[model samples]
Target chain A: MNNRQILSAAIGSLLALGLVSNASAAGKKMDMEQCYGVAKTGHNDCSSNKSAHSCAGQATKDRDAEDFVAVPKGTCAKIAGGTLKSA
Target chain B: MEKPANDSLPCIAGIGLRAPHYCEVLEKLPKLGWVEVHNENFFGGGASLRTLLKVREHYPVSLHGVGMGLASTAPLDQAHLSALCRLCDAVQPAAVSEHLCWNSVPDMTINGPMVINDLVINDLLPFPYTQEALSHVARRVDQVQEKIGRRLLVENLSSYLSFTSSEMSEGEFLSELSRHTGCAILFDVNNLYVNARNLGVDAKAFIKALPAEAVAEYHLAGHSIRDGCLVDTHSTQVCAEVWELYEFALQHIGPRPTLIEWDSDIPVLAVLTGEAEKAQQRLEEYHACFK
Candidate 1:
């Protein structure tokens, strides 16, 4: 094959691989709000001072307990590792 | 007027009344011969205790304990015993029962399903039925009986493994303990069925060997299949095989205060009442044969 054609094919393969990896990674990301919704309804919220409707406070406390690291704004970098990041 | 003889429990069939259905059962006042509840669940005076008190007004309640650690080498938990005594005073349960197994150890090595070193697994733990173990269990039973100011029924546990060092059979240990402590037996038919299938223990021999007169109650529950063995998950409906075993037990041991126990994935009150009705039918049939 010609050198130009070979270079074009190599670029195409890398782009395809990147897209596949991104798609796989995207599948792992969970919607935190949806998870909170399920937990609020599914389990008995035994948090002493908070009602079930105020689950946002419990979620914040849980996130704080895990020392969760938030993703930087305006950056498409990979999220930090932890259950909260996945959520 | 004198209170009726408590010995009449042998002719009744009851259901394990859990928290979820307490209000409905008490409000509707279902025709339950008796009701049993886990003693641990009502240790503290709260909504659960209040509900149980209301139910006690209408039915005879049996306090079945799940966390006594009767055979544990560790010192008996005073708090647990005190809680039980308090409950006994409040509810005046017709009978109280704990399992014939250990869930704790001395050197902080807890033995049970969910263990964290010295901490108990919050589940019953089976042990080898050696003479020493029997003596330990008997002593514990004696203490529980003394504290409660009444006889305590010890239930046979459904075990997954058999220890190579077991010096005697579970039935022998239980019979011997009863002889020594005068404690009653709560003969759980489902546990025997599970052990018979999983550990090659003979269910018929177990039923036959138990001292009939000492049997104060019977427990029937459903189990789930796991890894080719049956675990007493108590989540679903009682299987036909277990029900048949209950009938066999009723015939062998005679009708006793049988309980339909469903702990997890509990259904509506009607479902449990339906199961209790089945047991009541079997008990009535047994009574018919005797007559």
Candidate 2:
């Protein structure tokens, strides 16, 4: 697949895992996100020992966005409080 | 953006350069040898990249990636590699590295008759250590290095489980990987400690297996016990035992750029500064030995 397809696939996985949100953008511009949520067992972004704010102490309530994922652009706006973290 | 590009990281101690400490670091310009950061955090151009560029203006930065999943069975993620390329082009980091563990895989199951393949992003998970696995990892490392236009440093993992079908230890796997692909070793001491505590891995033996020059960086962190298993939490002071293991690494693997990683329950900047200072002392002693 081409770059856009490759990017979309990666971001799609991140969105599926709920690590990032999905948002639509102008022209098929592929974007990735740094989203928060409990991504994996050993692989959550940073341990969410505290409330969500930054990478440090990113622990959230049960199954929240504790894991940071590279999601497609425009996805995070759909995620409540999920800011677009990356391209 | 106007600061001179740092050629290399000093054989001294550095911190992970988390967001919490960015402002303080940029303002104070404290006495740190260098700084390391998570590559993904600065993937896109924005305030984060701007802040990183400012940080780059002062000290050398090491780009450490947590989500590369180099060993996953699925095809390598090109977008991730592209983002890294862009980041490297912008930051001109002293070192770029990723973990040896596999963090994602293609999901394969069936709805009774059909199969599905979904990319499963995970924390670093265990994989076999066979020649086949080694070949796969080396090929991926080569792809990454070729894309980034530099030698990538692959780190050791702090595993909670073991693969009985594995053909070699993690150290051996890393050593052979380095030898085959010419990638260097990041040599995370705390990871070895966690594995040993949790899986009876021999830390000293692992260090002995490495080629000294291949060890380009060292990671020092703290671990917490979860259900009686050690976790590479990176959330506290560098414990005394981990420090001892680090000393062992320095003695065996020799002095390299070391980083103090504290991710969770991050305390004040002073706390990380103190931890870095401790690591700095160990580094100094290692250098003094040659003097």
Candidate 3:
């Protein structure tokens, strides 16, 4: 098959398998907000500002200083001590 | 509305935009001169690229790369290069930069065809600063600039140890590399400070040796000291000593686009902005000296 034909078949297979469509659909509706002060120790999304750990899952305290979790907007405030802005 | 693309980096203070602050920065649109992000993070089309594009709409973006491995003996990673090219096309970044270090090497061949698989160290590894290495790095820089169609800014590395085999200083090697490839320099003051503390590098002499005209930008980051060795962890505020060295650099190299980079233990958006504001104050102070 020609290069164009090969490319078309590969993309067609991805579409038929719902991989491309699923990713496209997911990308369109991103509403996740960073909910701060709620993540358990060693359970944060990425890095922390007040802690020595730089990578994910390295927080040393339960009430992390600057670590966060991604939750839907307006729900973070409902959790006790959770704020949109970092403490 | 999509903001017009800006190809020139403003000589002002900015923060390194990490993943945690993306949502907040996008939502609030804080006043900033510019912002930089690791180019490798947004190589694919998804939420990450989408958010970066949205950031491009507000502030000029600079693409800082960590995985280019410019001095690697192995052939340049074409796939990584192509991805970076596509990212530049999409973002129209004000600047593009990579570290002056090696990451991978070719497969080892022992006596009588005993071959070992190639290894990628996956970290910024330093090499001896010699004429041979200089020529090799210069050739690689030429290839990268040709592929990207722009001058690549090479940042000096923060090494923990010095090589006895090195024939020249890191600053001299960088100067020769810029002279050979016509590339620019991204002088990281914090990296220099770390080298000074850890390896007893002469920070002042290194700064004086650099080709001031080739310096296109400056980087300021915080580091941590462990067991008498300073590590460029970028997890805290820029220390007083690094700031002093930065002022020395400003006096020598002149004011340039400076960035406050906090990678590990990423801080709150306000803290990052506060750090950027401190850098802005220093830049203005230096600029007022001439005016």
Off by more than 4 A, model 2: A1-87, B1-7, B288-291
Candidate 2 residue B13 Cα shift, in angstroms, is: 0.4
lDDT for B120 (candidate 1): 67
Q: How high is each candidate's TM-score?
A: 0.74, 0.76, 0.77
Q: After superposition, how far is residue B75 of candidate 3 from its true place, in Å?
A: 0.5
Q: For every candidate, what is the interface RMSD in angstroms?
A: 15.0, 9.5, 7.3
Q: Please give, for residues B189-278, the per-residue lDDT of candidate 2 as tens digits.
A: 888888888889887888888888778888888877766777777777888898898888888877787888888777888888889898
The TM-score, computed over Cα atoms with residue i paired to residue i, of candidate 2 is 0.76
Q: What tens digits encode model 1's per-residue C-alpha lDDT throughout A1-87? A: 899999999998998788878875774463332223222433422321122111000111133535655554543455445223554
Off by over 4 Å in 1: A1-87, B1-10, B109-117, B288-291
User: What is candidate 1's lDDT per residue for B7-67, written digit by digit as tens?
Assistant: 3344577887764665567558988888887787677764456667777888888888878
State the displacement of the C-alpha of residue B221, model 3, in Å, after optimal TM-score superposition: 0.6
For model 1, the DockQ equals 0.01
Better of 2 and 3 by DockQ: 3
Q: What clash pairs does model 1 have?
A: none
Cα lDDT tens digits for candidate 3, B66-139 = 88899999899999999999999999999999999998888877796987665677777789999999999999
lDDT ranking, best first:
3, 2, 1
lDDT of 2 at B285: 84
